[model samples]
Target: MKAAWYGENGGPEVLHYGDIPDPEVGPKTVLVRVEWISIEGGDLLNRIHAAPSSDHHIPGYQAAGIVEAVGNEVTRFKAGDRVVAFDWNGSHAEFFAVPEHYAYPVPEGMDLRQASIVPIAFGTAHDALFEYGGLKAGEFVLVQGAAGGVGLSAVQLAARAGAQVIGTASGEARLDRIRPLGLEHGIDYRNEDIAARCREITGGKGVDLVLDLAGGKGKDLLVKALRPHGRYSVIGAAEGTLPSFDFFELIRKAMQVTGISFGRDMHTPRVHQLLEDLFADVASGALVLPIEREFRLSEVREAHEFVATQHPFGRVVMRP
Candidate 1:
């Protein structure tokens, strides 16, 4: 099968597209003939920082396609079923094999391109806001990097749940695009002070919760934007610099810091149910996720570079 892989971690230039051996289907595997691949933040992070587990390591988190085959042990899915699949890696290929549990049925009539991007971006945002952050209606929740996939997802979910949403993006145009999705206020991170803006927006009490999607130097500002004992959900680092909290920083603010890794709980019955609902919501147009661009699998290098440098509003997808 034709696929993209990198021997070592670095930039998009490190990625090479060629034919590699098809993955072996295990007893519990669901083999998908990949149609669309979502370029997740973790996919880029892993390529840049995580060491390859193999010389032919193919990196990606999610994809949607027809089930070409399924293991004998797989009972829920059969050949020709449509599914959106998740795994630690290997989505950037012609065929993606995942455990049956890692696959979610795409709603009938939903586009594969749209289904490909739903689970990770929406599930991660949902978990960060309510399940872990304890966000309540009427509370002020600040979303950092609101233009990205998870950021946009958080905006809609929080807004629909009755929370006031404050989001940070790079420009007025981008922020304008996000406002109708239930953003109560928009901060231009490139031009405005996030901490000061949050204070102003929340009447100096700061936000009740902070969703840190872009992790980097801006983290300190997000920390400051939180109210005392506020919840902080650490989600992603689009800036490519991993941020850390010192002991004093944590102690002084009395903040509750929770690191959200949606993948850790994705295989559970709880998450499967959550994803099923989310997929339906998306299919019904009750939820929205925009795809900024699409590329062929052979153009993986250019796709990765565009996502890293262009700050795509929602997601970038690839076709096999």
Candidate 2:
């Protein structure tokens, strides 16, 4: 099968597109002919930082396609089924083999490309806003880095739940694009003071929840932006900066910090139901995720570069 893979961990330049041996289906795995690949933040992070599993490694988190075959032990899926699949790796290829549990059926009337991007972006944002952040109606929620996939997902979900949504982005245009998606206030993080803005928006109390998508030095500002005992959902480090909280920092704000790894819950029954509802909402236009661009699988390097540098509004997809 043709794939975009790398022999060493580095930048997108390390990636090579060519024909590699097909994956062997395990007893409980389903083999899919990938149609669309969602270029997730973790996919680039892994390419630049995580160690490769072999000399030439395929790197990606999720894709949507048709099931070409299934293992002997797989019961829920078979050939010709349209599905979106997730795994630690191997989605950056013409075919993907994932455990049966990691495969989700795309709802009827949903586009395959749309289904490809749903699970992670929506799941992470949903759990961060409700399940973990404990957001309630009329409360204030601040979404840091709100133009990207998960950021936009968060803005919509928070707004739909009746939480006052404040989001940060690079420019007025991007923030403007986000406001109609349920953002009550837009902070241009490049220019405005996030903490001061939050304090003002919440009448000196600060936002009830802070969803940190662009993890970095900005964490300090987010920490200041939260009310005492407010929840902070550490979801992504798209800025390529990781922030650590000290004891004093935590104690001073009385903040509750939680790390969100949506992949950890991908196989659970709860997540299944959550994605089902999210998918239905998306299909019905109650929720929306914009696709910023699309590229051929052979142009994997260019796609990665675009995502890292362009700050795409929603997601960039690649096709085999």
User: Per-model C-alpha lDDT, please?
Assistant: 0.95, 0.94
Model 2, runs deviating above 4 Å: none
Best model number under TM-score: 1
**TM match of model 1 to true structure:** 0.99
The alpha-carbon deviation from the true structure for residue 108 of candidate 2, after best TM-score superposition, in angstroms, is: 1.5
What is candidate 2's TM-score against the reference?
0.98
Q: Which stretches of candidate 1 lie over 4 Å from their true place?
A: none
